[model samples]
Target: MSNYSYPKLFLFCIGGTGSRVLKALTFLMAAGVDIKASQIIPIIIDPDRANGDVTRTIEILNKYRDVRSKLEFDRNKFFNAEFQTLNSLDVATGEGKEVGSTTAEGFRFGIDGTKEGRFKDFIAFDKLQGANRALLSALFTEENLDAELKAGFKGNPHMGSVVLNRFSESEDFNFFASRFSQNDRVFIVSSIFGGTGAAGFPLLVKNIRSPRTSLRNPEWIKNARLGAITVKPYFGVKQVDDSKINSGTFISKTKAALEYYHSNITGNNSLNALYYLGDTLTLDYNYNEGEMGQKNMAHLIEFLGAMAVIDFMGLEDHSLVTEDSKAINPIYKEYGLNGDVKTVTVKNLGRQTRNRVFKPLTQYTYSYLYWSRNLSSFPSNQPWTKGFDDSFLTSQFFDDDLRQFNRRYEEWLNEMGLNERGLKLFRLDMGHGLLHQVIEGIKHRKKGLFAKERWSFSEFEGYLNSVDGKVRATALPALFMELFYMATEKIFDDRIPNSN
Candidate 1:
């Protein structure tokens, strides 16, 4: 209904873990979860160009953009926040120097000269002679030297730290600095056990906290309210022969990263808020060093990590005090549930988490189910149609963009519901008793003892017919979204108990 009025939030997602967390964040936004930031600028920093997880997330983001661009953010707040890329913004560094054009497409940030070749080649190992060569050999194993750069660091944080140290000099960081205003905030998502995330998190923070003179708006860049979520080991991978990645090393790697962070990040108050999330009941996924085979399922930890982003943005500015580019009172946070169960429901979540997510998710679930079930059956002659025909329903807006978004949304829920420590929020397999048994533990409240206990698809259509005129969109796609948003909101308020 209205445009963004709040400040932008630059979200820096690093590595495979980062990509998964961002995917969770995107689904949460689609479900109309309240994120205080008006615009989210996702800067994905991953070297594995062919990573399936990253590829899938990028596809979802592009589809989200296409779908949300067609509809207004009405009362239901579905896809209300705006997202932008670094190149899309108007940016210039110090002395009117423009940031160089990037080679990375979409939301990714390309590291320099990493497109092809070996790790030894990237560092110019052949050029070294005598002690220099010997020192390099001492530092890196033969396998490390031969590791493919494109396949990622393969759990080698040492390699990642060296490779990612140049992040400050990247064009993407410069563009981000130029576009940043004083009120804008930054949040980083990474993992402590892996290569890219473990190394990139500290290096990225160092660059932001101590900006170079070449960067535009250096003071604002240095003093901005910063937050981050560092995911610990929550999943493992199957043992593969001759693979550089090893699940047995995760705990040791995490411990090392935590020590380094304590000295350089938390000890010096580098961030305003730091959120930590992990689980011991890990799921074993098929191992691929990187590339297309690296896709992993959605986990409860990633979902909670996304919630950390929302919580960070919602904090009061005064709580995050900074003096000369250093936080005065940095906050550390961890997530917990009301009960530790194998299958999670809305009621099992902590009160704050439940209050923030349950209602919005339920409303969107209702909208999705209703539209998926009844969209084709609506009479073309209804007043709500405005004389539109079946062609409008079959247009690209509905047939392509909306359809793809719906499919992905449904898959995300299913993935989380089937993963270890599953978040079983809804019973998606049901065909009947939708209003009464769709949600895992919550249900619609009946009007009276004698009245119908649950509403059928016919009753849902009747409610739609009653409210279609109230939606104020002229375009068919916008009208369609508005109708569902309004109907779901009303249905949630009138029928769903304990929704407040």
Candidate 2:
């Protein structure tokens, strides 16, 4: 048995950006980014059942879980991490069978009466007393209250707070609390400007830190290691007819949310650690409040937000909160870059950030490119591909599941590259010779005819040949990942100059 015992990390992804960032984190984890936790449970909270971003993220998480389960845990660095839905964990613990049919279906918790109900009906405006009715009227416009609740709160936290308050009584919440162990930790990801995120973050934290008496293991849940990333406004949407969302209101909404957080969140020491991140260079997305049209391009800030989760998991126990009864300072963090360049490269990132991500991302990108482009043409005598027959290569496991995942991974990186403060890690346009295109900012100085053939399959094969002894015990995913890591590092030294 492996010496390493796995711990669980429960993640609450609150809204649209929350889902997108979680998707980015999933990709990074697949690339062997160290999250430090053994298992991750992602819980997505959004009213829009047909939300494009949320749906895509849930699909990715399901695929990740399926792939990881097939590759048995062997202390390998690649695909070593495990992902479980809250329902799976509950079922494992003998709490109950899952309510939803699939893992993606299990990811969401629907808000009662939101689908076809109006906000006024949701809050029972006619049933409230005069002062309460007046308060509600003052807080929400008729347009806001009369608006359909199925889509979302439309960037209004007033409606979200009322609707999301019911989450504590949810069956999923009970299951989550039942499975909560003393060693488990919780992390939240949300955008401060949007409705579901803005209202959900604080409420969710509050409940976790002060779980109700009815919840299983409430005491343990209260003391769990908690961390959160509150994303500020990082993108704008184009104005469209009858749209309630506006780019201009992002700052104001963020400011309002920050003020509330200061008093209720930071002032009260509600969280053990808090991470803040936003980009001044925001991307302009097509305007859509909800549904399939609301899909936004991946942004650099979302990547940074994902990084914060990894960083938080690495923090020493009690570093963010005091072990004793006395109050301790909460850890506060903000993302920064070394340069002000619009097109961000490796050098633009902080040394620590670059060091953590660069090598693994590069290696994974190389591995993916090789599999997609060169694997078929490479010599069959290669040890790694020796046992692989045409039927095996064409199997649904590889041709469908793994192939689709690789394509999504490439698309994820491409979208990030195209977004503002772009992470130009790979040249997205190239179809072949992808390793040379790995480092976008660096200049390659060719040494000779062989140098012109740098990053070729033969060179990659030669590097694999050199590492025969190191990979003697490694199998499939790890063997493949280890080979790519070794090959990429060698090529970096031989071909790319000034690379750190």
lDDT of 2 by residue, 1-500 (tens): 23135458899898898899999898888777777786888888888777889988888877776666545433334455677777676422323323332323467755557667888988888789889999989998999889788778778887898889987877667777777777778999999999999999989988887777776676667777889999999888888887798889999999999999999888878788999998888887888888777678887888899999889888887685534211267888998887888878887888778777876676677677777877764367776555446674575555676677888788888888888868777775655644565577766657466656335556667776676555533445445555565666666566666554
List candidate 1 stretches off by more than 4 Å: 1-3, 92-101, 381-388
Q: Candidate 1 residues 154-272, lDDT tens each?
A: 79888988888878887777778888877889999999999999989999999999999788788888899999999999998889797678899999999989999999999999999
Query: How well does model 1 score by local distance difference test?
Result: 0.84
> How many clashes (backbone N, Cα, C below 3 Å) per candidate?
1, 0
Candidate 2 versus the native: TM-score?
0.89
Lowest lDDT 10-residue stretch of candidate 1: 91-100
The lDDT values for all models are 0.84, 0.76
TM-score against truth, every candidate: 0.96, 0.89
Off by over 4 Å in 2: 1-6, 72-76, 90-104, 126-134, 322-327, 431-434, 443-453, 468-499
